[model samples]
Target chain A: MTFSVEVNGVEHTTEPRPGQCLRTYLRERGCFGVKKGCDSGDCGACTVHVDGVPVHSCLYPAVRAGGHAVTTVEGLATAGELHPVQQRFLDAQGFQCGFCTAGFVMTTAALDEAQLADLPQALKGNLCRCTGYRAISDAVRGVTTVETACPGRAVGASVAAPAGPQVVTGTARYTLDVDVPGVLHMKLLRSPHAHARVVAIDTADALALPGVQAVFTHEDAPRRRFSSGRHENPADDPADTRVLDDVVRHVGQRVAAVVADTEAAAEEGCRRVRVTYEVRPAVTDPEEALRPGAPLVQATGNVVGEVHGEVGDVEAGFAAAAAVYERTFHTPRVQHASLETHGAVGWLEADDSLVVRTSTRSRSSPAARCATCSTCPPSRCGWWRAASGAGSAASRRCSSRTWSRSPCCNCAGRCAWSSPAPSSSSVPPRGTRSPCA
Target chain B: MDLHTVEQWVDARTVDAWRPGDAWLAGGTALFSAPGVHLRRLRDLGGTGWEPLVEDPDGRLEIAATCTVARLAAHPVALFGQCCRAFLASFTIWNMATVGGNLCAALPAGPMIALTTALDGGCLLLAPDGAARTLPVTAFVVGDGRTALREGELLRSVTVGPLPARTAFRQASLSTLGRSAALLIGTRDADGAMTLTITAATPRPHRLRFAVPPTAGELREAVEDEVEHWFDDLHGHPAWRRHLTFRFAEQIREELS
Candidate 1:
């Protein structure tokens, strides 16, 4: 349903689905400052002011934001004027990649001068992967005055102080504050067991649920697999994932997706989805997966690949050292917990091309290659062909060099015909070690 | 907004006028962090036109339930003001959090609860029946994330007696940016009577009062006997909490005397 919301003193009527988060709604409305890092509430990247109070937009339901004022990083400055907090961040160089800047600004703006003095506690919820928090703290402290010229000024500048009923007296608009139209709520049916093979699936009950619009299973989805992994050439890697798969590898892995008129309906549809699984022994421990007797997590065994690159011989280096400290530092898997959860809105064009608006790590590559090649599987194995082709060429060159080194080359009188002529003048002479070598 | 929708705001004002499914909105710091909360609606009880700060007629201090920690740090009360300054460890979101919010949120390591219980403060509880009752700060917090607040009741304000002429506060945490693992507050009255309050180590505040300065053995026994359950979490274990409670209790008692 469409609802009216006032953001930064402007009112707009928009439609929003119950499960649709405020962060996605605001981004769709062209507020790109709201970043999505981790879809979980751990990271404050999606922080925005809801009724003047700072909140993680990812956790708040868009429907709950109806008739409320939302404030984002774009609204911090008044008509090209910067709020003191934003200026402070700029002066202190509080941000690096700029993804987390909006959250810091929104959180800082919510605090008063006294609270700003001791900020470690106040800003604890807002985590920055970069800068180690020194500059952020400085920025928060540097902006003593409340007003400035634009949203990008230094904290030290003198501007009109933020004067309102109370500093955060409940009138801020956030991304979730937007009310959209014709929105459909979506939910995913996740696997209960860690690893299992889907033997039978049923979705008729889910489609019959009230307000249910669509139910997608592996049978209805594209057969091609895609890689969700984030890397430079994701297609070259083990792109083993599919939109919906018969085999579930992780407990939280999506088995099916349901779109409904309401979030509650979508949730009900998710519950109605029935799937019979042949549960398998799951391997959660990465170390155990490498052991000899451990159950293989993947068909090709659990070892993804080992990274071993050395500039010099490690044994020689260790032997030369008077004292060696060899210790393994284990870092547990940590969720990014970005305030904006991972979500995408996809619409199929009349031409059959899909227009997907999603928060993804891979945004630089071309869409077609990224979606089909980088994300698609089976074609990823083609990377092995490329690597082997280079290796074969290198081995052929080495064997020809060894043949040319033989003393029989001159006796047999086959040296000239046996070895191919150098392709360029830069190539070294076969008999002599040329300076170019 | 109409009362029907207003009942869902969850602030100090709405907390006082609570209907069903209403919970007090403190800083909205903790409540907003948790997803799928049991509360269907929030009654906004924040900044409800109440006086944020007030000094009592007898030279004591009474702060509004909605007053932020930032305000308390600058207030005139010595013990409370010092505790408020130390409480600055959690300052980034302090501007919106209220004194009552901190107390009612009832995290064992909550700095405000340690401060109030240390000062022998009392909470003014306004029940939905239009009757008001007062409970000692030590008795108010029942357990972690738990409080003595009855349904449809609100904590109006926290009242602290004037510093007993001389008072000192000491608190410690595990990390530089960590919550307190243990907190100790000691006060000496004019008649040579001393009171030592140990918190952050137990589910409830452990307060020991002495007509005369107590010995180390007496202090240790009082702490062990008074505090029912020692707190344990990611911050510190229950055994460590008990050990530090006794250690700090003796330190504060000697320092106050």
Candidate 2:
């Protein structure tokens, strides 16, 4: 049976792809605004209005959309004018990184004025990472003016963010939105057993599968070690990790990466690749990990880094003191929960220069900045500021100094002046390197 | 998850065709919630044209299998709001997930099972051969994710009681969001008797009755004796669910009493 859907007043009647989700269907059809943060409806990034009712489109079946009226973030505005909700968002500055803005807009569009009072309950399904929800709340409540929107900060001055219009109207492109034709989809075969050494990997079946491009194991990775830490002076950063590792230090570590023509092929290739493991005892505790006979996490000893600077005989100064006290302060390990997840797109230019686009906030280059180990010269490989936060960026060969904005509602064509981010960059890509999009 | 094997979707009301890999699609929530490559075809009930809800003159209610949770909560039945709130799901889930799907998913955390079991509800099931049978909600579910649904049988609707002059109190674990680890509902019948419906904490809904309000010790004893299969999963350990069930049972008992 033909699957028919009226999306944003346009009817699309086509043979439905088997088991396709409404989110993927809509996204594939140029509804770039309908984001998919968590495909399981955890994040409201894929929220859309199905027949005037808000729904997590990620959970809706594409075939089921037949005869349903679907409205996405892109459809909110009419006659090239912004919707009132979108306008209010621009006025209130209701976003941080704007990754979750589309979902918030869709959900807020369905709510009545009274629902704005209890946003925690009304917008319970949608989640935001950076804004702390204050600006979003202000926008939903239609609190115009910067001073009223946020009293303490920007009291008298009013300023819009880099991509507010595009963000609110769902026109801004994220790392996942970038499309390069011929880009092969890669799926990681994660180690199921924690602290196990991958003894053997049989990729003959995977390679035999149709559409299978390449199957990469730790044995095949470029052994040039690199650290994923943030250190301006590269010396302090420990070059511990690699593209892939035989010894899985933890569960979900990348054991192999299967490249294929399609996502399904890559996933099936990953499943077909058999792996054998040697279980090892794990040291889960910080104290136990530092013990004398503990299993070493790295080839080197466990004490990876030590900070000690002798300032004019510190021990003698302590001895001369009236009394000496010792204590060890403890703090929980923190993670930078950026609104945008770690993602990047890499491709080789005609000149064989690698250009990568990622959500690297204010950083220069991914290959030059994030993946720095002197393997690739900084001039040949570099990144420019793209999306929000100091997330990630990489490059091996490219001109690295253009600070172009991502295409959005206000600056869609204008932003394409200097090697701009792809407007409809879906597919037709070249080269390789995408870490978690 | 993609049901790649699914080749056709037949309306549930049209033909009595039952294949080995056929699955009933009502709301398609839990069924489509995750991947199921085994599902070959979907038997959809959207074309069944069954009334979502039917009200009896004697205050009885017959809720159709396709009744969405949001519709039921919006219903005038006040106790329904209390039971529907047990879902802890957002409006998105409530608008899509169906009552029959909840019961047939047979998940221990299904609030519909808990609600029906408490109200002494009965299930109306129909076989592909046109044979019909009605079973108590307590007997409908046998274990976690396992239902008494025979192959090719369809759960048509559920009939819930004449809820008048009945006092009910519900307690569930976690926040007002997501799945419940433990949910307990205590109701005082018009006859001055009480029943505690324990759910989410156990494999199946448990209905414990007492002519009068049971003492804390008596309630604890009945709970400990009756519920042998306390559910254990990421939601909660069996012991934790048991502890919370017992604790909520006492609190609900005191309040209802």
Q: Best-fitting candidate, measured by TM-score? A: 2
Docking class of 1: incorrect
Query: What's the i-RMS for candidate 2 in angstroms?
Result: 2.3
lDDT for each residue of candidate 1 in A74-134, tens digit (9 for 90 to 100): 7788866678776666555555434466787888888877557767767876777655787
The per-prediction CA RMSD against the true structure, in angstroms, equals: 15.9, 6.9
Model 1 chain A weakest 10-residue run by lDDT: A381-390
TM-score per candidate: 0.67, 0.83
Clash number by candidate, in order: 49, 17
Tens-digit lDDT track of model 1 for B19-99: 565666554555554443245566555447777777777866677887877677767667666666555333434544568
Query: TM-score of predicted model 2?
Result: 0.83
Off by over 4 Å in 2: A145-158, A307-342, A362-365, A369-385, A389-437, B1-23, B37-41, B56-59, B125-134, B142-154, B176-181, B215-217, B229-247
User: A266, model 2: CA deviation in Å?
Assistant: 1.5
TM-score of chain B of each: 0.88, 0.94
